[model samples]
Target: MARIAFILLCHKNPDAIIRQAEQLTAAGDCIAVHFDASADAADYNAILNGLQDNPNVTFAKKRVKCGWGEWSLVQATLNAVEAAVEAFPHASHFYMVSGDCMPIKSAGFAHQFLDAHDCDFIESYDFFDSNWIKTGFREERLIYRHFFNERTQKRRFYWGLALQQRLGLRRKIPEDLQIMIGSQWWCLRRRTIEALLDFVQERRDVMRFFQRTWIPDETFFQTLVRHLVPGREIECRTLTFLMFTDYGMPVTFYNDHYDLLLGQDALFARKISVEASQLHERLGGLYASDQMEFEISNEGRTLFQFLTGRGRVGRRFAQRFWEQETTLGRNRELMIIACKKWHVAKRLVAGIRDHTNVPAVEYLFNEEDAALPDLGGIETTLEKRSRHRRALMRMIFDHFESDRLIICLDPSSLDLMSDFFADRATVRLLEISCSFDDDYLAGHARRVGLAGPQTGADTMARLLPTIRHDMVYERDMMRDADFPNMTRISDTGSVDANAHAIAQFLGVSLETGKTLAETPHLFVD
Candidate 1:
């Protein structure tokens, strides 16, 4: 069995840190903690007192005051690693993680996997060749010297870089060194750690060069590991599961993320919220197990889909950057069901979802209305809600990347309805006028606060003919002069029958198992 030593770097939440230490130490693994020097003294002392009885837990001799994108973070990590190495010489592997990290699997599983594979698990990508750095200065991170804290003093930091750029002041990277960067967390073999320490002791100039570079913790060890170990022995990936936003901020895990995290292939997960006491309590049971191998139920497919890129935003809404009509083309197959009745419209959305693979959305407009709730506290401009509805539609169309998008519109979305009808080449417009049924018309009028059922019927009869529609669904036969294309649909028909009529018009097929109407909360009114 491979013995593992954990290096935990922390700044706050002493109680949670203590809980983590207890769990790891109980698993027959040793841990070394480095508390940030700037943190409260009470927090540090509390951690010490809590773990004082455990022989497996130790603390760094000195704490370094850490900051985001600064050299201090790397220094604190070094202190913790050194402490772990000195305290646990029998440890065959060293895993560096944050204090917020928790194991998803038993410690035995991690040890067994490490023992089975002799390769080092760390994400190392060539700095210039890869697009890992998304938000900030990419190439400049290596050439230009960064002195200011980028997060705290944003203006001065940029100003400093700008001044350097103007002066043509650039530092030459250490010769013969292939620069690499990746996630800060890593699990390295004992031999790799020894080799890395030896290189650091001999290369003070290289150390000084990285000291002034941006976010050195993410680059320092990652760059050095390439030269220290053989390429075949490196796995080029981390064992810890970490997620970040487009802005490069870590996404904190919560209590409800148990399934998402546990199903992942990763042995450990990081950036957990301190207040996630229930998650902490649940994960506390995963320790000191004799079971060596466990099956990963999800294998991380669903988790990554949710955490990466534009997909991070849920289906109902998308990022503001993606709220554009850039992908709209003549090849698009989109259908707009301009229906106002909540009861009938919901079943239609559900039926379409159950029978067809096409993505169907209910109340694509009027999200702010009672049927569908708005994104909490998302303030919008004073412009008409139609503009907002159009933007959301464009985002969904772009993000979904499907052959067809079936949308249900609200009573108030006339402007949106008109906009889609004008685009005859791309959109297939379907109008469900008040002729569907007397009950439906009455319900729609009452729900929308119209004057009367006849008033609602008259409004649709007068306005719908002016708009171009490929098809109209009605319960009673309409005058051929008004509806050139008509499909008689019984309001009393089965949901499947209504779904089949819709599928037939779109040249698609329907299945019966899963439906969108089941998730009524996701649909906006």
Candidate 2:
């Protein structure tokens, strides 16, 4: 059992921190809380109380004040790391997380991943060329004074103190200094942590130099580690999925994005807010298991089995095929539907399944050509179409139940389908259109007395209107004509030819068409 420790730096949101601690505990991982002294101790105690006799949790003694762009935040983190090392000396790895950070994977899997890599997971991107630091400096100088100074009710001197450091007025650092950014949240091997600590301790001059520098959080550890262990076994990637707002503040993850986060293969995510309580609740299940399932089948099989049992076996099978196609490149038990021609869908599915690594193709026949002979005894015609469409949709949805979905459709189709099923499930939508230059289709509707050409004058015009007006008839006709060709309706040409065009338009790789398979519903309505 490789031991892992979660070091969380918390402020006022003790409730969130406590919830995170509980999640870590459920994963059989140890938690260490480092409360900034500036925050209320009573609140910290309340947080500790929530943990309630959890043997895996420990409250750190040292308290440090942290300010953005100040060295204190990094200092506080280093202090906590040192304390965690001493307390959980046998821990295989130490993960530095914020109160806002949440684990996306089980601690067991995290431990195994670290054990295998023997490398630290810290997203180290070249920030030197990025406008981030420069922009931060400008915002502090101008925006900080314009907005925050008045809101915080701070004196002129205090505001100046805050802004001066952020604006780089307090430090004479070089303009061309190589800036590197890793996630403030990271998982480090014990050896990496010790080496960092050693470097900080021995190089007191370097530490002192950085202490007075601007944006130390972005610079301190990155500069030191790059120098200490140049080209060492440090992953330039962080195991955290973090979303940033336009203002650069971290935003809470939406519940709908849960599947995306899971598919990203990252270990943790950061900046979860109080509003994301529902998201936290959902993720709790992923990390709740005592032992992490590393094998792909172990993770996928359970979900697949459940979906298959729900009378969604066909869709589940498709999804399984997509996964296999993406991972193994062997297409065995898969199906393809070409809107253009039956023979094309059939031959492509058959050829891929038989010759390539793809699974057997279960060609979905159009209602007109080969009505579902299986449902011959069905009574009502309307009921039959509904049932058939539902069955077809179910198969598509099921295939994507455990994998990422990449929907390929025109803007009109995307608008219709997304609006129709907005509340049904949590799936990511990526809208694509083959042509951006031509407004011929837009003008054709106007000529047919359906609607005028879409103009940028109104925001509503920019987006496809959800309301089904008479204009939608023209749009529908256009869609029907285009969708079939797009899906390789012809048997004479290759499915790969048209499929490749669609995939290219969507900016995705044509690897077993897994993205298309996973994304079941294409809007043509």
* Candidate that would win on lDDT: 1
For model 2, residues 208-318, the per-residue Cα lDDT tens digits are 666655556766666555555556777776677675554666656666545545544577876556686678887776787655643221122222232233321222112
The weakest ten consecutive residues by lDDT in model 1 span: 468-477
Clash count per candidate: 4, 18
Relative to the true structure, candidate 1 has a C-alpha RMSD (angstroms) of 14.9
lDDT, each prediction:
0.69, 0.52
Candidate 2 CA-lDDT value: 0.52
Give the alpha carbon lDDT tens digit for every residue of 1-525 in model 1: 888899898888898889898888787888999999999999999999999999999999989899988999988888888888889999899998787888888887887788899989989999988988776678788899998998999899999999999999989999979999998889999899888888889999998998998989888999999988999999998999887655667778899777557656788998778888888877778666665554454324332432252211222223233234433456666776655455566666666665667787776455444233243323132233344554445556666767578777653444454455444326654544433344444444344433222333444343233221211312111222232222323344455654555554556544432132233432332
Relative to the true structure, candidate 2 reaches a TM of: 0.52
- Candidate 1 is scored at a TM of 0.63
TM-score of each: 0.63, 0.52
Q: Which 10 successive residues of model 2 have the least lDDT summed?
A: 327-336
